[model samples]
Target: MAELVLVTGGSGYVAGWCIAELLNRGYDVRTTVRGPGKEESLTQAVSTVADPAGRLTFAVADLLADDGWDAAVKGVDRVLHVASPLGITAGDPAAMIAAARDGTLRVLRAATAAGVKRVVMTSAANTASPSSYATEGTTDETLWTDPDDPTLIPYRRSKTLAERAAWDFMSGHEGPTELTTVLPGAVFGPILSTGTIGSVGIIGRMISGSMPGVPRIGLEIVDVRDIADIHLRAMTAPAAAGERFLATGEFTWMREMAHFLRDGLGPHGHKVSTRQIPDFAVRLTARFRDPSLREITPSLGRRNRHSTDKASRMLGWHPRPAKQTVLNCAQSLIAHGAV
Candidate 1:
């Protein structure tokens, strides 16, 4: 086999795509799972999108523990740190932040200790989004999310803090290591396997009619395949060192998304609702009718736009537009009989 690459959380929806890209590119993969027994799932996920002859190995590693990560990194040319504690609503912000910040630092420390030359971390647009406050002006990579803002989502806060922790660790590390961060906006696209893609549940719920109206949020989406490609590019592309690449394209709001999906299915897609719910109506109705709407009410009427200018210039990355992302997602759900 050629040089090996270590992928953390290979069984995860996002990481699974990363591993698939690595395997398709003919990299020997040593993936770390929270349990060694989940090797079947990892192998299956990789196999779903990879060639039949791809090579995959697995180890047990927990982000909270220091047990197997060092060994998992041995002889690997690059590390893809995609593991982080992800949750929507949590009882404790400190616990969530620790899992994100400390968990990332732990892996980086292990990578340094194991002499890995390059690391491509899975970051998110949430790290840089200004959704907590009114985004008056155009925002891009230059902006940082206001984590202390009371309106920030717990998951967004976790991602922002974790990415910040990673940058700090990289700055202080004396090792001959390079770190590249791939920050994708709210990701949506087809699943490589029968299993679910984690971040797409909200979209899926909307498609399945479980969500009557979409979140007030807008998504700057790119294909999962495109996001995975940038991770690989970030690993070896010399210019990508110490860079944060935004793997995204144009933005799509709730009504735009519904239209995109509805257009795709022709007859079937017509079932989608394109009515834009007024922010006040949804908010007021939530108190008397539905709590689920209340859960997503905080993000109502927010505009989210991310600039991928740096990505195109530095990594030579080009992402599929958000419209295609929504269309493909709807098509995939229909093909899989989920819609």
Candidate 2:
């Protein structure tokens, strides 16, 4: 009998790829959806890459609430908790923190009780980063972002808190089930469906000409496929338990990202902006024109980078090149008519 792995959030961008990779590798898979209607679409998305052939199943589970989790983890051998709070730019910080932190505990409590072999949760690379990106150096899993920093944004703070809470929970846990965490930076790459694009929205906006200029910020772009691969590696690897792996890919400035898109996608990338937006202009816009731009003002001229040495040395994981990942993401958005 094949090992059965439970991937939470079937409809998510990363989770969808996880499901496809799991099925491709001959693992009987089950994924969680918040409600009933998403199952059909989720199956359709995963089917584009690999045939489920009745090896895939679905369970209704929401992280914010406690219902449906116990039944969801039943009979599961391993779990990939890939779900996270979304659209966090303009919401109540308290609610987002609660959803992320409490929701993770909810999954952990249920998975521990069910005696699942291992639970690999998806966290962000930002969780292990310095509060200010002004420092120049490469950081790794040893560093921990301060969740209570007053300057931290809701999204960063939420991810850090959630990961911290999970570690804290496992410390007191005296059970057979183990825990591992994979922290990915700026997930990009091919999309299974356009329903949830996540960070790929910036590429969509750029390709659509909605964004007139690029910011000075840099991103450690990791392919979604590579993210899925690392998650699977972390799930079953004996050495991965109680460890955090940074899956941050090659670092590319936003200006360089624009050029990559423009050069790679000739006709399709015509609208992509190659001009860089000045820091003062971005700050001005954030202050008076659009408050949403405030979040990015801090990242202007970001100097910090994350090292993936831990993941490479431990799990033998390597991510695709930044240019390849960027081009693939842009082309996929164009193909899906998302631009």
Candidate 3:
């Protein structure tokens, strides 16, 4: 068999698309799930987009430990390190940070040891900018959150630490391995399986009246497919080495998505709402309740836009409009009975 492109966390919500795209693009891929028994969900997800060419394979792996990772990359040609913990629910903050940073380094260490040529890591805009959780305006590659800052969100801090550590290891020292990072912001798009989609949970709450009022924060909502595309391009483009490409769309208001949920799905969909709480009102509500709301206040009335000139000029990468990405996700969610 030909060598496969190894994708960590292949069973993930977003990485699954990248796995399929790799399969479609004629690269045999080996993806890792947390355990051996969990292959069913991963296979079902990849099958949704795979062409039945039998090009995808699964390797059991975990982010918090190093039991089987070294062997997983033994014969792989390249590695797509897309497996990282996301969303803050419950767990040791220090452990999460350790797993993200150490676990990523673990794979790179294995890839380098195995003589793998290139590695594409899935990073986030949060790592690129500290104010990412803030509710307004545009943030790009220029921003980097202070790891020592107490105000940073746990999940965001972990991503920043993990990515910076990886880059430091690969570039700061000479090695046979090369690195490329894809920094995506609030990615949402087509579903590869029948499950809860990315961050669109906030959108559903808005239209269902679950969220009595929309918060004033803004997001640079890029589609998952676009994010997946960026990963693929980074893997093949020789110029992508040692670069962190910001993959995001124009700024979008929180409630504006309700219109997308209602009007955009048009002709065959649900239309729940187009109403919103004013920025001042949200600020007031945020004041009495949570400090997280303070983070939401900055972008209440602005758009966080970015230029794709670099990714475009160099790798021919282009993202569909944010509106279209939202529409596709909304439709996928409804079709899958998630909405």
Candidate 4:
């Protein structure tokens, strides 16, 4: 009998790939959805990569509520807690924090009670970054961002707090279930469905020419497939327990990414603009045009990058080139008619 792995939030961009990769590896997979209606979309998405057949199943669960978590964790050998509230600008920052921090605890409590062998949680790279990204250096998992820093964005604070809460919960836990975390940066790659692109939506917008010009921002690109691979490695690696691994690839600026899309996609890439938007123009636009732009204004000239040497050394993980990842991402968006 194959070991059953439970993936929280099955209908997510990263979670969908995790499920497909697990099914391809011959693991019987079960995933949590907020409602029964979402099951069809998840099933359709996962089926695109691997034949779910009878190996894939779904459970109703929500991070904001604790109703179906117990049942979701029951009988699972391992868990990948990939579900969390994410937004650049939230109407209520505290609510986002509560959902991320409190919701993580809910999953941990259930996993510990069920005696699951291991739980690999998905965390963002921002959780391990400094408050100011102006410093030009490579940081590792050893550095922990201060979530209480008022300068931190809501999403960054939520992710940092949630990961911190998970570690704190395990510190006092006497259970046999082990915990590990995989922190990924700017997840990009093929989209399983057009419904749930998550942060990869930025690439979609770029490919569709939604933005007039590129901002002076950069991202440490990591493929969605690579992120899924790291999650599975963390779940099974003995050295991964009670450890956090940063999964990041080459850092590329928005201008470079725009150029990549424009040169790589041929006719389809014609819409992608390689022109850089002035930082002052972006700041001025944020003042009245869009409130969400305010959140990213701080990162207009980000210079820092993350070191994934820990993930490479410990788990023997290696990510594909950033150009390949970016080109594939744009191609995927085009194929899916999402652009």
Which model scores highest in lDDT? 2
Error of 1 at 206 (Å): 2.9
The parts of candidate 1 lying over 4 Å away from their true place are 52-54, 87-91, 285-295
TM-score of each: 0.92, 0.98, 0.89, 0.98
In terms of lDDT, model 3 sits at 0.77
Ten contiguous residues with the weakest lDDT in model 1: 131-140
Q: Per TM-score, what order, best first?
A: 2, 4, 1, 3
lDDT sort, best first: 2, 4, 1, 3
- Cα error, residue 270 of model 1, in Å, equals 3.8
Q: Whole-model lDDT, candidate 4?
A: 0.91
Error of 4 at 113 (Å): 0.3
Once fitted onto the true fold, the runs of candidate 2 whose alpha carbons sit more than 4 angstroms away are 87-90
Q: Write the per-residue lDDT of candidate 4 for residues 97-178, one digit (tens) a residue.
A: 9999998999999999999999999999999898775777888999999987888888889999999999999999998999
- Between 3 and 4, whose TM-score is larger? 4
- TM match of model 4 to true structure: 0.98
- Please report, in order, the local distance difference test score of every candidate based on alpha carbons: 0.78, 0.91, 0.77, 0.91
Report how far off residue 54 is in candidate 3 (Å): 2.8
Candidate 1 local lDDT, 163-261, one digit each (tens): 888899999988888899988877778876556567776566666666566546666777877888888988989988888887876777777888777
